[model samples]
Target: MNRLKNCGVAVALLLLSGLTLQAQDSTALNQSEKTIKKYKPFDANLQLRSLYIWRGFKVSDAPISDVDLHYKSKDGSFQAGFWGGASLNGNYKEFDYYVSYTKKGFTVSVWDINNFSDFPNANLFNYNNGSTSHFIDAGIAYKFDFKLPLTLSWNTIVAGRDTYVKANGKRANAYSNYVQVDQVLWQDEENSSLHVFVGGGFAFGREKNFYGDHPNIVNSGLTYNKDLVLFKYHLPVAATAMFSPEHKTGTLQLVANIF
Candidate 1:
């Protein structure tokens, strides 16, 4: 009888030990999972502007609101986003989607640009050649690591509705291209900065192009940006003076961050 009692106590202790060991293993596994886990990062922005000006052209004369949502990699080397803008008077609307990758000081990106105002009845998903209203643009930029802070970029329309009529009355892809340079004149830690930029447009062929009949400077501008704290919230504001020498037009624009 005493032997049987000893055997029962030994079995109970063995089961208890086994359960404790299992619990400890589970806790270690949980900690290991937490250590290796990663979370995705995303950002959203909204802005209100006095006008919708892009490159060197006036997209909208009325007030416009812009919004963007983006997902950025943890290392900040990759990003994908959607950006949209709409005018208050309902005359202008634009939607664009892009994906970009950056390494060191060089960046490459592709953008799908859609101007709904130009083709109000156009189907959004129609990607057929010569029938779609979308424009696919590929761009590359390099930021010089200099004290003066300068960046240069070039972009070209590779596909979609970027077309023009040739001398033979045949529609041909224009392959419109724009090259730009930006330099920062001054900046402070408080996010106040002044910048000057210039851009020109040309086409692969010498015929009538999307920008103009001849290659000319299309965008030149000065922009001043400052961040203000209002009600304990960071509000960024900017003023831009833009001129289009090709069109002989100019505009002054104000922008404010809504959130």
Candidate 2:
């Protein structure tokens, strides 16, 4: 009878331990569910810059203000955005829209770029081939998973105003191309980083076109980026010193994000 009583006690203790383990597991699962992060689909921001420079050319010496609006997929593999910039002196204006898809470390995108500096009277909605100011570009980029971050990209103008005059006195698509490489020299846990980049432009056609003649090293630069906290607000800022070997020119720019 004592042996049977001890066996009963052992069985009750095992049952109690199993119940306790199951309850603990249930609580852990609930805590994990609560800790999962939620995705934000929409974002918008404005940037102010001391100068407007692109590729190797200085577009505007005046202060520039840029606005960006973007929508991203929940998984972050797809994005679409509109980016526009204007000079304070109102001499230069650009509106661009792009859609991109990313997988692993590769990204491909299409951009429609419109500049009103050349054709101030052009209609924004007009897609008429010869009369429109829109330039269509396609690009691909790959980021390497290395000890130091590295990225390479290629962009080409495929259609619209990026054209040249042929020998026969006819306009032809120039198909301007630009290739770039960027490396992150240093980055900290706080997201402050320094980057160095170089870019070159090529003309696919025989005639002169945008980005000038073929095979020109256009943009080479170093950028320092950091975030500052002031008055209980976080602000992001960058300072860039860029040089164009082809153009034999250099410029400095400062940018701030006002959110």
Candidate 3:
């Protein structure tokens, strides 16, 4: 608890320091306002992908399609979005909703995850029941503006059916947690970049099964992304190579987004 308090204090201090710096620059404030004014409030994107993978789980062997719709506040401080994925061959399906708040480089968000592919009978509305389909995750993230921009995030499932067995043979919420670090190596456009990321899950809770039953590195990858204007429409393409050292498996995927 003390450590968590300290972390909260540190994030508050960083965000406050950033705000102080921004306040000292009138030109920067004006530019930010201009950028906010030109920002669109809503966006939609559909992605076609070679496969469906999350963390270390290859959820689907068939091709995948993903859709996202989002709304953001003008100042970019708050956002709400729906994200859904489906396998082209009807092997996998997922739907999730998230809302986030950001201050400077710090962010916090809550996600409602509905994974229907694993158990078709999982009830989305069954919160107190043992067979609920919904899982809730809370996350905190920070992005550093250093020379090599870096992002760090921690997410933990706090509620729902993700479970573990207690010593007494009772089912309990696992609170499975995952942490990741990402760094951008190159960028030629606002939406296009080359990045490297590494992530792992804590062994406790449902992570035992979620991350191969032990505390180990699960998802590490290199990704290259580019946004192009084709036929006067914005299209984004990404190529990724992901490796799971714990599972001794690797995958390569190509993704294209149509907006």
lDDT for every model?
0.90, 0.90, 0.85
* Sort by TM-score, top down from the best: 2, 1, 3
Tens digit per residue, CA lDDT, model 3, 10-88: 9999999999887879778898899867879998889999997788677788999999999999888999999999998
lDDT tens digits by residue: candidate 1, 1-259 = 9999999999999999999999999999999998776555888999999998888889899999999999999898999999999999999988899999999999999999988787878898976657787889999999998876899999998888888767798877889999999999999999999999999999864745567667889999999999989898989999999999998999999999987
Steric clash pairs (candidate 1): none
- Top candidate by lDDT: 1
What are the models' TM-scores? Answer: 0.82, 0.83, 0.79
| TM-score pick, better of 2 and 3 | 2
* Residue 118 shift from truth in candidate 2, angstroms: 2.5
Scored by TM-score, the top model is 2
- Which ranges of candidate 2 are over 4 A from the true structure? 1-36, 205-207
lDDT, candidate 3, equals: 0.85
Error of 2 at 243 (Å): 0.5
